[model samples]
Target chain A: EIVEAIAGALGEGPLKGRRILVTSGPTHEPIDPVRYIANRSSGAQGTAIGAALAALGAEVIFVTGPADVPPPEGVQVVRVESAREMEAAVQAALPVDAGVFAAAVADWRVAQASDRKLKKTREGLPVFELAENPDILAGVSQMGEGRPGLVVGFAAETDDVIPHATAKRARKGCDWIVANDVSPATGIMGGTENAVVLITGEGAESWPRMGKADVARALAARIAAELETS
Target chain B: EIVEAIAGALGEGPLKGRRILVTSGPTHEPIDPVRYIANRSSGAQGTAIGAALAALGAEVIFVTGPADVPPPEGVQVVRVESAREMEAAVQAALPVDAGVFAAAVADWRVAQASDRKLKKTREGLPVFELAENPDILAGVSQMGEGRPGLVVGFAAETDDVIPHATAKRARKGCDWIVANDVSPATGIMGGTENAVVLITGEGAESWPRMGKADVARALAARIAAELETS
Candidate 1:
């Protein structure tokens, strides 16, 4: 019943001719076959956004890391595991009308991946060398050949969400940044609920707490409206 | 494992001495025994934020409407069914350190609820007379008795998300506004993911897309950090 209402709403203007690209989930920095460095992200947000965009009549290309949930129907899903692979996949799905960077890409990756699991040494803890992973959003926003009309990034901070998010937008050269706090207790990482702020070049907009699906639908509709005016 | 990690991170903070008031979910304005005016809100975001605040060691008072999900443990929860009830709950819970208006409250309610379901007319659909609901966030923000130090509101708009949110913040007399587009296609009404912008007097901060759980954690951490510095 609700799906029919949504379908009726989608039969309109704005995103009809646009192609959108989205990235979701946490990128793993492999340490060994049995171990890796990754955050507790489930990619629910990205999948919802992709579904929302598709419902708005836009073609969606979703690049995702390993996630516990499945991608929504009707989206072009490209599965990847590591930051490197995710970056490659995003790059391949270029020339999109808009790009939403929803993936919790690891800031750093293991310098070298070991194919086999390492046995625990009797001697204390082992140190793993880490290297900075390329900022996929920045790379795509600033260097992609088919530059998207609008590039959106996320700033997940434990403190100073707005200040850090503002700086990140400028540093990444993206058109907008969505800012949120991710201190462990929130349960927002794998939980079903969310609270968020939308930041752009002009200013910031805060949303009421609701379901992630509601947020995604609202965002897709806003994007479609913006595209129409642009 | 995640809960332990969060507890360790929030060992001590400004929120340690603070009290927070939060509202979540949708208000059901009943028209008849079997029908009511409500939205598709699950109160996930508000509950997550409440849990986040509690995790940070703040005394949290949560006033929620009808919700499918449970509130975070350890926080004082006040359940309500109508917008009027939510407003009363918030007012009673006031004099807190901060207030987050994350609930997706109905804007209107039936002026008078029928004790029994009204039979459908053989000729046409029934019409309902609705009255404007009190703006819970705005009212609480402007209250003089034990008003919170920081008042935050959320604006869910389909078009001109930022602009409309900015106006809402000013009109509501809140310290910050979280804004997002909640059009039909986004599936944000009852889903698990979200994308949003935070708008404040200083400006706006956009964030990338991530899980709602991460968003809640980050927001809790930010509030704690901000309270400490201020």
Candidate 2:
């Protein structure tokens, strides 16, 4: 353990001298004091990606929401619960060589979140006025300075994976977009295996179904190679 | 590990000959094919409760939703994603010695969930027609023939914890209600520690702030005693 720590401190591997930022899990946007809006993100893929990067000797900053899986070992973990918090955490861990936006951030938050728990009354249902959350991927990709050289975003789709992801790559202005089908038929959501298509400025490349850990390793290697070339 | 397994099979402890069903985590309600509505429940307390019950030699069937922490060891785990599925799972595990409903089930689901991803358009925001979900706790508690001897429900409240929980006990027809304040100021939501007020027909008892594991063990012990007497 001591030897490994010393080696890590010396920064000695394929991704040595490089800093990468990764986001994982589902953010919880407050609805009331006890209630929140969230999604079904286990953070398995993101945790694997962070671990893979670290294994390659990259200094990884893992900004995570409430995740089922624990953050990978040997990475700086910053926990946040809301999209706004995740954005702030990402901003704080800026100036990286690459950034991976893997979190399933909620798109909207209650416009007027109640400080107290809303009681169920005889009156009609409580109306939740929602406001759009900030676009972290677009924000980072369009940054004028201190932006990562490679900005990768994820799009979990049920259909038209390629077309939608291609359009998303252009819309979000990210260098790469990892798209996957998450329909109930796929059993991808909260499942161990993943089948993704990598969309980039060059074109779209479909990868066969693989374990999330394998995907992470391959993606990390690709990131290293891209950084070396750029 | 082998010896522990043998002991578990023998059921030679306080809760021997008992079957306990526990529900944990937050149920996800689909809005669109790629989008969902969920609550902020990590299932930490419920996971610990399952572990504690198992430790007391109770055969535990854990019905879980998408949870942050992994399901406890020494229990049968049944995974579900939505409130409807959870209710079905619970009903299937009926005729148990006790039932613990710890899941933060979504109160509402979209009336018509989209078959495909809802695209962002220039027209207007997509309105989600919401419908109330079935009351799982009430349904289980009102099961006259097959209802467990002891039925416990959880109420995550921000204010008026005691009052609300006391009322909830009657409304749900449950034997006990474990209530806690999840206000941001309280730091209980997604946190490891808990301070709960256990409400019963007898009265409400406030417990000191403690680790979730400790609370689970205490609650499990209480359940064992109640079952033994009943």
Candidate 3:
């Protein structure tokens, strides 16, 4: 561990002298004191990406949510719960060489989260109103001056994978969008294997089904090349 | 493991020939194909209880939701996800000597969970409607015949602990109610230590703060005594 940290500090691999930010896992939006809304993101892919980046000698900053898989070693980890918290954490980790937005952040949260536990009462079901969360990817991608050299976003869709991811890339103004079909049949959402489409300005490139770590290594290599070229 | 199972099968302890049903963990109510509502139930207490009962030679049938803690050894484990499935599992495990209702089951679920991932559209946030879940404890307690010899329910309250728990005991028609404060201030919800109140027909008895496993053993001992006396 000490040797790895020394290597990272001294700048040692393909991504030497580079700094990258990777957000992994699922942001939980609180409903009240006890309950919350969550998505099934185990953070396996994001953790793998962080490790891969670190293996390539990049100084990695891992901003994570409450993930089942723990964060990788040799990276700065910043943990957050809600989307707002995650956005704040991302803002704090600025001016990196590249940014990878992999966290499945909740799009909405309970508008008025009660201070106490919401009781099941004679008043019937409570009114549940949602407020839109801040768009972390779009905000960073569109930033004028302090934006990273390459901003990458992720899209987990159930249908029309290529079309949705392509639209998302254009809409979010991101350099690349790593899209995957997380349909129940595919079992990719919480599974170890992923078949992803890399959407860029040129076009969508589909990768064959592979382990999450392999995909992470491939993505990390691309990121290193992109940073070196730019 | 084999020896323990053999002991349970051969009726080697105080709770010999006894059948106990225990439900643990938090039931997740789906919001969509990707999102779900969850609570901070680690299932520590219930898992401990199952172990304790099995130690006393009881044939333990453990019905559990998605718990952070895995089910203990030497018990029949029935894994469930939602409140409705838990209720059905409980019904199927009837005619037991005692029943421990420890799961933090969701009181309500989305009226119509979407098949596809909910998209953030221009129309604004989706209208979220909820439907009350089946009262599992109350239903089991009010059974005319084939009801367990002793029915136990649990109450997690923030304020007015005794009153809420007492009222719950009456409402659910359970023989005992284990009540605890789950306010964020008290780390008992997901923590190993617990300070709980045992409410019964006689009165409310407050137990000193202790490890969840200790509490389970004491409760299991009491259950053995109660069954023996009857």
Best by DockQ: 3
lDDT of 3 by residue, A95-185 (tens): 8989999999999999998888898889899887899999999999999999999999999999999999999999999999999999999
Q: List runs of model 3 lying over 4 Å from the truth.
A: A1-11, B1-11
Candidate 2 per-residue lDDT over residues B78-141, each given as its tens digit: 9998899998999899889999999998887778988887766667456677777888999989
lDDT of 2 by residue, A1-230 (tens): 34434555567667899999999998888877656777668899999899888877899999999887899988999999999999999999988999999999888788899978776666746778877889999999999888899999999988888999999999988999999998889998889999999998889999999999889888988998999999
Give lDDT per model, in order.
0.76, 0.88, 0.92
Kindly list the per-residue Cα lDDT of model 1 for residues A1-230, writing each as its tens digit: 26623662564345766889999987766655434555446789888888888877787899998765789887789999888999889888988999999998876666776644332344623455656677798898797577898888987766677887888888889988877766556666667877788888888888887788988888888788777777
Please, what are the lDDT tens digits per residue for candidate 3 over residues B1-230?
A: 45644665577777999999999999999988889998779999999999888987998999999998999988999999999999999999888999999999999899999899999999999987999999999998998889899999999998899999999999999999999999889898889998999999999999999999889888988999999998
TM-score for every candidate vs. truth?
0.49, 0.84, 0.96
Q: Higher-DockQ candidate among 2 and 3?
A: 3
Residue B78 in candidate 3, Cα distance off native in Å: 1.2
Q: What TM-score does each prediction get for chain A alone?
A: 0.92, 0.95, 0.96
Give the C-alpha miss distance for residue A158 in model 1, angstroms: 1.1
Query: What CAPRI grade goes to candidate 1?
Result: incorrect
- Candidate 1 error regions (>4 Å): A1-13, B1-230
Ranking by TM-score: 3, 2, 1
State candidate 3's TM-score. Answer: 0.96
